[model samples]
Target chain A: MNTLKINYKNIYYPPGGILMWIIIFLELITFGMALVAFVYYGNEQRELFHHSRMQLNTTFGAINTVFLLTSGFFMANAVHQFKEKEIQKSSVFFKLAMLGGFLFLGLKSIEYYHKIESGISLDTNMFYTFYWLLTGFHVIHVIMGLVILGWTNYGMTKKDSDTITEDVEACAAFWHMCDLIWLLLFPVLYLIF
Target chain B: MQKSLIFVYGVLIALTIATALIANFMLVSPFVVSLIMGLAVFKFSLVTFQFMELKKANSFWKVSLTLTLGLIVLLIIFLK
Candidate 1:
C-alpha cells in the first residue's frame, strides 16, 4: 500500500510544494496591486466608475463566481481522492472540475461578446480599462488552468501512469489561484465600485 | 473529508449569492461596499484555507496569506 508523505512542520515544504506557494504569493501580490490601482482610479473618477459599473452584468459575474468556486471544490476533492489512492474517482472529479472551468469560460465569452458588441473596449474609460485588463487577464488564467488540468488528468488516467499526489496538488493549487483571483476580481469589478 | 468539502462548497455558494444580492438590491454606499468587501474577504479566506489546503500548511504560509488578504481588503476600503 502506497501512502502520501508530507512534512507539515516544514515551512519549506508547504502543501503543493514551496515553489507553487511562491508563485501563488507572487500572483496574489500582482493582482492585489492592480486592484489597489483600480480603487485609486475609481475614487478619482467616482461618477465615471459608478456609471461604467452599472453597465456590467452582475448576474453573469455572480454566476461565474459560482462556477469557479464549484470548480475549486471539485479540484480539492480530486486531490483528496488522489491521496486516498482512488484514481478513478479522482479522474472523474478532475473532469468535473474542467467542466466547471469550461462553463465559466462559456459564460464569460458571452459576456465579453455583449460588451464588445456594445462597443466597449479597453480604452473606453478609466473603469473599463481596468475591467478589460483585469477580467481579460483572468480569463487567460482560466484557460491556462483548464489546460493544466487536462494534462494532469491525462497523465493520471493513462496506461502505466506515474501521476503522484504532488502533481495533482500543484495543479489544484494553480486552479484555486484562479478561483482566489476571481474572488478578488468579481467583487471589485462586478459588485463594488 | 467529503462531508467537510460539501459543507464548504455550500457556504461558498451561499456567500456568493448573498454578496450579489446585497450589491444589486441595496443602494450603493460606503457601508454597502464595506459589507460586500467583508463577505468577499470571508469567502477568500474560506477558499484559501479549506479548498487550497493551506490549513495543513506551515503557520508561516497561513499567516502570510491571511495578512496579505487583510492588506488588500484594507487598501480597497480605504481607497474606495
Candidate 2:
C-alpha cells in the first residue's frame, strides 16, 4: 500500500526514465509519419515531388543544419560541465545552446516569410505540405527545447547540483535527438532535390 | 588537453566548410553530397559517444537509437 503520496508534478517532471521512453515513442511516431509521406509521394506523383523539392531553399536548410549541430555541441558541453560539478559553466553552455535554438527559429521564420511572399504555402502542393509539416514540427520541438532550457536556467540559480544535473542531461538528450533528426532531414529534403 | 579531441574538432570544422562549399559552388553529384552528409553524421556520433561519455550508456538505449536511425535511413532510400 503506497501511501507516500507523490505529487502530480513529480509524476510529470522529466529525467524520470519513464518520460524518456515517452519522448522516444513520440519521436518514433513523427518519424513514421514522415516516412509515410515519403512513400505516398513516391507512389502518387514522383516527378512532381522531385520538381517541388527544387523550389525549397537549400541554403536555409544548410544554415539550419549548422545551427543545430552547434547547439548539440553546446549541449554536450553543458552536460560535461554538469558532470564536472561546475554548475555555473554548465548553465552558460545551456544558455548558449538555447541561443542557438533561437537562431534556428529566426532563420526558419525568415525562410518561411520569403516562402509566403513568393505565394507558396502548406496546401500549395504535396511537396510544400510535407515541407511545412516536417520543418514546422521540428520548429515546435526547438521551441520546446527553449522553454525547457529557460526552466533549467531558473533551476540552475536555485536548485542543488544533483537536481540540476538531471535536468541538464535530459535536455541535452532531447537537443541531441533534434540534431540527429536534422542530419537525416538535410540530405533527404535539401540535397536530394 | 587531448590532441585527439582537437584533431576531431578540426576535421569536423573542415568537413562542414567543405560541405557548404560543395553545396553552394561545386554542385556535386548526389552520391558525393550523401557521402559528405554521412561524414557529418559520423562526426556528430563521435562527439556524442566519445566526447559526451555516452559510449558506456546502457546497451538497450544505444541499440534502440541505432535501430531508429537504420529504419529512417531505409525509408529515405526508398523515397529516392
Candidate 3:
C-alpha cells in the first residue's frame, strides 16, 4: 500500500495554501471597513443612497457575475488539468480564465463610461463614493488576477511542468479569490439597497 | 465528476440571473428579498463545496476558511 504523507503544521503555514487564507483574511478586513463606511454614509443621506442604486444597471452587474463565475470554473479546470499532468491543457485554461477577467473589465469600463456621461461621477454623492470605492477595489483585484494568470502561462512555457505547478496552483487560488470576492461584492454593492 | 460539476455550474448561473431579475422587478419586502438573496448564497456555497471539492480538503483549513467568510458576512450585517 502506498501511504500519503500528512503534515499538520504545513496546513496553517505561509507559502502553503494558508497563503490564500491570509489573503482572504486581509480582504475580509478591508471589505468590512468599506461596509462600515457605506452604512455610515448611507445613514447621512438615505434617499440619495437608495436613488443612486436605482441608476446602476443590474444587467451589467449580472453579466459581470456570470463572467467571474465562468472564470472560476476555468481556473478549477486548470488545476484539474495540472493534476492530470496535462501542462498544456492547464495553460490553456489559465489563459481562458484571464480572458474572462479582461471581458469583465471591459464591461465595467463601459458601465463607468455611461455613468460618467449621465453625470453620475464618483464625486456625485456618498453612494457613488461607495460604488466607486468598492467596485474600483474589486477591479484592481481582477486586473491583478489576470496578471497572475498571464505570468503563470508564461512560466509554463518557459519552465519544466513540475517546477511550476506550485506557482500555478497559487495563481489559480488567487484568481478564485478574485471570483469569490466578486460574488460577495455583487450582491452587496449592486443588488441590495 | 467534472462534467456533472459543469452542469451544476450552469444551474448556478441561471440562478444568479433569476435572482437578479426577481430582486429588480418584484415589489417584495426587503426581508423577503434578503431571504431570496440568502438562497443564492446557499447555491454559491454548494458550488464551492461540491464542484470545487472544498469539502474534500483538509477539514481544519476548510473550517477556518468558512469561519473567515462568515465573519465577513457578519460585518456586513453589522451595518444593518
Candidate 4:
C-alpha cells in the first residue's frame, strides 16, 4: 500500500499511457498550425471567407458537435467502467460512442455533398482550400477513430482482456482526441468567420 | 464520476445550442467572431479536462494542451 501510494503521488503517470499522450500533443501541434495558416489566409480573403461561412450549415455543425460530445462522454464512461471491472457495461458504452461517430460522419458527408454539388471544390477559393483539406483530414481521423474503438471493443471480449487496460485507455484517449479536434474544427469551419 | 460526466455533457450540449443561436440571430462582428471562438475554447477545455482526464494529468500535459489552444485562438483573433 505504501509503495502504491508513493508511486501514485510521485511518479504521476498520465491517463491512457505516455505514448498516446505524445501522439496527442503532436496531433494537436499539427492541427493548430494548420488552423493558424487557415486564419492567415482568412485574413487575406475576407470576402471569400465570409461567403464560405454562409455556405456552411451551422445547424448541421451544431448537431455534429452534439454527436461528438455525446460520443466522448460515452467513451469516458467506458474507460471508467472498464477501470471498475465492469466489462459488459464498458463495452456497451463504447458501442454507443461508435454510433455517435458514425452519426457525425453521416452528417458531415451530407455537408460535403452539398459543397460538391454547388461547385465548391477544393480549389474553389482559399477558404474552400482550407475547408476541404483541414476538415477532410479531420474526417479521416473520425474514420480512424471508429477503427480504434472497434479494436478496443474486440480486446474487451477476449480472455485476459483486463490485462490490456492500457490499450483500452489508449483507444479512449484517441477517440477523445478526435472529439477535441472537432471541437476546434466545428467552430472554425462552421461557426466563426 | 458519472455525475460529473453527465454534467459536462449537459454543458457541452448547451454550449452547442448557444453557438448555433448566436450565429443565426446575433449581428456578425469581430466580437461575435471572438465569442464563437471563445465558446470553442471552452468546449475544447471541457472535453480535454473532463473526458481526457487531463485534470488529473501531470502539470506538463495540462500546460501543453492549454497553450496549444491558446496559441490557435490568439492567432485566429489577432491575425485576422
Highest lDDT: give the candidate number. 1
The deviation in Å at residue B69 for candidate 2 is 1.0
On a 0 to 100 scale, what is the lDDT of residue A86 in model 2?
A: 73
TM-score, chain A, per candidate? 0.98, 0.83, 0.88, 0.92
Tens digits of per-residue lDDT for model 4 on A68-135?
Answer: 89999999999888777788999999999999999999999999899899999988888888889988
Candidate 2 wrong stretches, greater than 4 Å: A1-18, A39-44, A159-162, B1-13, B21-37, B40-44, B47-52
Off by over 4 Å in 1: none
DockQ rank, highest first? 1, 4, 3, 2
Better of 1 and 3 by DockQ: 1
Residue by residue across B1-80, what tens digits does model 3's lDDT show? 27966886788788887878777787645574465457546665755565455655567766766776666665555454
Give candidate 4's fnat, 2 decimals.
0.73
lDDT of 2 by residue, A1-193 (tens): 2222223233343232446546854785576568556655745886787677778888788778778767777777776666677778878888888888989999999989988999999889878887888888878877887887788767776845346455666767677667756665666666654
After TM-score superposition, the amount by which residue A174's alpha carbon in candidate 2 deviates from its true location, in angstroms, is 1.4
Least well predicted 10-residue stretch by lDDT in candidate 3 chain A = A1-10
Task: Pick the TM-score winner.
Answer: 1
User: Interface RMSD (Å) of model 1?
Assistant: 1.1
lDDT of each candidate versus the true structure: 0.92, 0.67, 0.72, 0.85
Stronger candidate by DockQ (1 vs 2): 1
lDDT of candidate model 2 versus the reference? 0.67
